[model samples]
Target: MNPTSHHQGSQRCGLDALGQFDEIVDVRTPAEYADDHIPGALNAPVLSNEERVLIGTMYAQESPFKATRLGAALVARHIAEYLETIFADRPRGWRPLIYCWRGGKRSGSMTAWFNLIGWKARQLDGGYKTWRRHVIDTLAERPAGLDCVVLTGPTGSGKTRLLQSLGAAGAQILDLEGLARHRGSLLGALPDRPQPSQRGFESALLQAIEALDPARPVFVEAESRRIGQLSLPETLLRAMHAGRCVRVRAALPQRIAFLLQDYAHLFEAPDDFGRTLERLIGLHSRQTIRDWQALIAAGRRAELFQALVETHYDPAYRRSSDSHYAGLDQAMTFDYDPTADDGHAQARALIAQLRVPA
Candidate 1:
């Protein structure tokens, strides 16, 4: 028996054994892969999304024999295509780790084909499900060991930009918004980009945290549990809440100016902007909503934005920050001028401060 193929029940070997392979091949449908997969794994699906769905329906409504026949034929065709295109250039000694939704037929078929063709391939035991469980387990304990510094500020205070600047200045930073691909606010969604799946977000977060030094303080933005549709891991959220706090302070005018520049897409797409405001109808009066919509129509965005800051975001931010962030009132305050450059300079200064022992 092959030493690597230590198949006890369904799993080929331990999860840590994944690093031994030349490549990780995800044989699940594209949709499943997109939702979440092993990081750095190549997508060489043995079944398309529609095909998987159709086969599943047939298995339930028709007969297992019929479903198996169709699925086997489709899997064979996909593997043939992969050999012709993706695997055509692969050398004889290439070894791959193959996985699907659950180390089932999809991954098994791919691994069998690769092995039959003179290359050694192993199937991931329990597949993506096992990998996901490992992520969840790691995250549950990962944050407890890291020293964290939480950066706190209201909306449009340039927290995300400053995080980038700090990262450039050699500071360890966890950019939650960047990972989620959303700004963590009502109007925070990017125009063309969609947020990652919940599992994908967790996977990204786990990898980022693992890369950081546990001995040094890692800087991260203060956020509520959720960033758009993605929820922060509970252990990570607790770590941020317990960390030392640094507040980024800016005047209303500066914040508004930064927001205007940052959210320029809203002006370009008035209808979408108006639709976002519709979420606020329950909180604000209908007249107020209409008035804000009118500002978009009249191209008076600055005034409209100012009103949102004063009436909505500021109050909510203050209340949340005061309650959630420990020692927030006594946090080291870093102020900046109105421009983006000034925000970066502030980040550099903060980095300098962090270098000195408290």
Candidate 2:
């Protein structure tokens, strides 16, 4: 079921009606809000951190009635404060759509309060959940008429970093790894951090793409639909498969050094490193993986990287390359030691050339 419009007064704003709203605010808890939120939402929570806990504990351990009274008291206090301080002398017919975690009492109460003040306020029937689903559905599927430039390279080729650098050079680029927060690999997971729910990931991607100029070319890292724990939206995967690929080839030593430097935190946390290595091992044959594990046990990190690239990583690259349409990946080999200024200059020239038809 859709997450919007459960009540009569609530407005059902799907992807289409989202544009009509003047402001969208998320009033969920800070932890919930931080995981990922509406692209431009203001976080004005009704409950303070401790007050929410007090209410939750009441609901969980005591009784729903006790929790209800406590929640109502807090909500009323905050709502009045907001109306007086934030929404004072608001424009006529000031329509506001308010939402909390489940489109329940918190949002419903706000809707009624605003209605009493002559504002056409509505509760989000499904709250943030509906918006999250909308975001995932849109990004997972491809929209029409978007040309893509996919950056193809082995792990630690600095694809994510390069995308940012290219964006700095005024090239429209999509930094998918940054959005997912997974870095798109077994080693990509940061310590104690889980990837966003698939729905959250889609919302972020759609927001990013919409901000770019559709008429201009877009640069993104070439990746499979799945990036670590999360999966790409189906639409985006198809778009990438059909897009032109730019092969960014670097030397083995450079890639190893880059990984060590970029992922220094992984080394600091033994559990993250061990878990990442264990997962990678399951993807390969027992002997090959065991051999790699042996290198790690012996503390030969660089050698382990070189072996994986020559055996696993390089083979995967060749297979992906072979399946492309004719002349799909126009190769651009860079020096193992690319000065920052030179890399930017080369990337800019390539992007401009990509803007022109072959």
Candidate 3:
């Protein structure tokens, strides 16, 4: 086997270096890989879910020597199969970065085989644990010199639309709701897609944040700590809370019109919509929920949306902004017409308003 390559400090093995290899391989079990692995890393588990469990049980109930021998036999069989299939197509110069849970036996065994087969394979010094630490540390500390411009407004005010517009117009934006696969409300879950696991969400968040330039302001929507089931990183929340705010203002009628179109899927499944509204039972009166359900059943969508905005969303928005966001009363107001405007023009004007005076 070629000499094993190792990093001196796992923490110092920044993502930049990890990106150099042709492939990043996670040789842990499928379940472990599913929990979370390095972003873009491919799963090629040396020990499968069942095999890992069997090895563990043997290690505990029997002796380490017997467990090692059994694990070796299984691993050898798996590797031989892989070589004839997955690795068979690989060229001689192919290079891969391999890791298991703790950079232990599973990955080491694979690395040894790959090297013997004339491929350069480097083992991640501390494996997934190191990458996890990097993610936590990166999120815990806000990017240096980063300034945020948070878009604040009541539900259905088109904050998400305007945020998208700003990004297309060249402003850096962190689309938290998009990343979380959530709309950030009780009725926010998408009709077709499920929200990502919390770990998956964080991995995406870190990757998105890392891609932006810290010298420029990142436009983000004002949000509660939690989005659907995932919570924003604490440092990110604090940064947004301390950032300058812009309150998007849209007339109530326009907001109602926008919601009817934006949330058209909810109307398609009235039962699901009504069941979702039931989550607000403790927050609103029983009679109020009954009325909302009555409207859903009757297909009085516009009226239902209007009532929800006035009774539930608007009140909660005011309380959240008033408490969490500093300097909200003095925030710049962006009057929006979601019905007529496609947001590009508004985005340009908003950018002009945000420009610092020379």
lDDT of 1 by residue, 273-351 (tens): 8888989988898889889999999999899899999988998887774467675766898885546556566777887
lDDT of candidate 3 at residue 327, scale 0 to 100: 52
The reply for model 3, stretches above 4 Å from the true place, is 1-16, 356-358
Clashes of each: 1, 6, 0
Best by TM-score: 1
The regions of model 1 sitting more than 4 angstroms off are 1-11, 342-344, 356-358
Query: Each candidate's TM vs. the true structure?
Result: 0.93, 0.74, 0.90
For model 1, which pairs clash?
Answer: 11-125
Using TM-score as the measure, what is the rank order of every candidate, best first? 1, 3, 2
Residue 151 shift from truth in candidate 2, angstroms: 1.3
Each model's C-alpha lDDT?
0.85, 0.70, 0.85
RMSD of model 2, in Å?
A: 5.1
Error of 2 at 46 (Å): 4.3
- How well does candidate 1 score on lDDT at residue 210? 86
